[model samples]
Target: MWFSRGLGSLNGVITIDGLVKRRGKTEILSGVGFQALPGRVTGFLGPNGAGKSSTLRILLGLDRAQQGTALVNGVPFVSLADPVRTVGAVLDGSGAHRSRTGRAHLRWVARSAGLPLSRIDEVLELVGLADAGSKRVGRYSLGMGRRLALATALLGDPPVLVLDEPLNGLDPEGIRFIRTFLRERAESGRTVLLSSHLMGELAETVDDVVVIDRGRIVAQGTLAEVTGAHRSLEEAFFALVSR
Candidate 1:
């Protein structure tokens, strides 16, 4: 049940165009647009309530936009023929039942996606959860739960990964692991799009950067371009979004 490292011919492009989302009279996103190309890690950076999660939600089809499109490859996520095999997403934690063991939770997901049960072990080990697979999810710590969520995302070995605040609960070691892993994925020609407020960590991981604030995109480009004339990405981010 070994999955290939990369989908050689598969295109893993994420196109977000003119995304506009409104809740009652307040707009959550305003004409947001960006492209996450394959073979690169794209960091979606913003402050809290800056529309980062909202944009990702629309991209993953968990939420709708009022006047824009979020497409993976050539079509929307909801229209993908084999979604589980096309895009792996990590959002809202593990989404696992409290009573289920980590392995059991992965087993259910594998079954639902028609993936081989053997993949469960592979992903568990990949996420460094091999020893904790038998632990009940409810008893796991926040970092452990995040790892399980990552394991679940890798189950299908999708070419595109969309994650929101992926570094939320990770420790230093876990952060290092994820940063290296994501870089490897991008080097292997996969698409990695992640939203996080940890600018220092993201500066090391992302090849491209997109900055959003107050539901609008204020800056976007290669890491160097976005960090132009700034001491670091953190400085650049604050300079861009500070109002």
Candidate 2:
């Protein structure tokens, strides 16, 4: 939300090595390893129960693994002196209370993150929510809620963005705006890890693809390499994970 200079050199590239996690008696992740390099948008792809959310949680330090480590810029995320300034994440919900106005929600986050109050107005405008700043999130459409979520993520202007299903509920214009925004962030040498089920979208947006199934990585490479003989990413995804 604080619109200073854009994040300059982002060292927050994600690295997960030999990550293993188990819930109850079931193994959720089996030595998963991947790298999301800076200056690129890395697409994390998998079917339901494929361990994507588990891995993301570990990376964000919201959950711990029974074995192995997940790092951001070579340091575990929890170890970052200023985690907010290092990485901004977007998930399913806007993370805003339903009764809170869009601006109220951002103000709360700003105060919690030690960001200046000025950022409330700046980020509201940045995500095209300036006109609706006073509107309660409950009354906002799905698309508007998503815009608010994104605005919150940008509040710290963090160099690394880890977004899951970011395209949810977006109109054509919203989708286009997000595409361009993410591309520009990556081009500016930031790290972006995007997890979405929209294969066609990822095919157009991501520089690299990582596919996991049944708690293990099945394939990972550039679009061309992973797709191989398939005509599209969706085809290749079905082929790789089905087995």
Candidate 3:
């Protein structure tokens, strides 16, 4: 288990406490909290309109929280001087320019991060995009685009990775490949947090889970602990959120 920081002993794990989010008068998330540990897959789950994406945006510092805190290594993501080296994230793949080759897009990102060009090919191969690296990103399929986004995430090989709906629009083979890839990353002593609407997929890929509903975390623990002998994770999940 990863220990907390000195003195305060606040867990080095990714943590959010009393997290509240709002847009004008609309509240999106309220009292959201969870911890993501290194070397494990923490599945972030919620139904549509349940604030999963909002929470991920806050974690990436793309959206600031109106209340509470989102921290990695006990520091807010925006406060970090070098976010790329500390955390790797793939919030959306549409950020890439349509006319750019996959390799060129990655090259620019790597250059900005002061990462070596070799790391670009390394991540491309890891994401099974080695053959398509020279192809224009707009010509690629949705799954291929997602893979490119993932490759961008791995460019830094950071200790923490946060992916949102990573398996969406993926083929069966793509889904399986990404599941294995994420598991391997966590096994190598990295933190892996994935948000997915597919609870069944989360069952197969995650070690722990955090369930959100109406912008709140309703359940969190090991898959087994949360399931508690239930026939499936879906069953346990529904039981919690439906409660």
Candidate 4:
């Protein structure tokens, strides 16, 4: 998190408005919209096939939408002059080639972005991969691979983070590490948009919640507001999506 430290000044608000997407004849996202304000951790919650991934893909500029926009600081992701310096994203899978060493993979990214080589060591240690950075990515365990992928994302020191299923494939300890890491980043004033199906986990970490179901947002507000009359976030999530 050191690389993204003190990024408050650069932090930007994340706005998703009326986004509509389609896959062949089926509609995947139907006028979805929300916000992850700067300096707060916002959880994007939805059941499977809830259009969470589709929304994230549009926001990260990984895919285009038929209508609406996902804006970072009031601009589209692809329109940014240097996206790496402004936003760091960690989507599904470790996103690292099995053939390259962890350190080598990071170095390549740093070089491509014109970032200094020293940032590599900093992020490696930040994600607790200093010792294994030299090992081949193929040999790393799932947890280690996820850490490396996170380290790669942090290398750019982006002020905004859009993470999709970051807790996937992690053991209990690994989950705790990432949970704490994300909270600390948000506490430090970085805008964080975390997408996951884990309601209990998000209840402990997010300041705000945005619940989506079947391509549309069912609710969006602070944890308590979103939870409504439910005993916990999980129960509230079930109620919202079950309808």
Q: Write the per-residue lDDT of candidate 3 for residues 1-243, one digit (tens) a residue.
A: 223224144333688788889999989999898899888999999887899999999888889888888898888988766666778888766458889999999999999889889998898999899999999989998889999988888887777899999989899999999898898988877889999889988798999999998898888899898888789999887887853
Q: Rank all candidate structures by their lDDT, best first, as comma-separated numbers.
A: 1, 4, 2, 3
Compared with the true structure, what per-residue lDDT tens digits does model 2 show for residues 1-243?
322334333265688999999999999999999999888999999987798888998998989999998988678989887777778888887778999899999988888889999988998898999999999999999999999989988998897899988887899999889988999999987889988767887688888999989899999998789989999999999988875
Question: Candidate 3 clash total?
Answer: 0
Q: Any runs in candidate 3 off by more than 4 Å, and if so which?
A: 1-12
Full-model lDDT, candidate 2:
0.87
Full ranking by TM-score: 1, 4, 3, 2
- Lowest lDDT 10-residue stretch of candidate 4: 2-11
Q: How does each model score on lDDT? A: 0.91, 0.87, 0.85, 0.88
Could you tell me the TM-score of candidate 2? 0.92
lDDT of 4 by residue, 80-148 (tens): 877877888888877899999999999989998899999999999998889998999999998898888
Candidate 4: misplaced stretches above 4 Å? 1-11
In model 3, the worst 10-residue window by lDDT is 1-10
Candidate 1 vs candidate 4, lDDT winner: 1
How does candidate 3 score on lDDT? 0.85
3 or 4, greater by lDDT: 4
Best by lDDT: 1
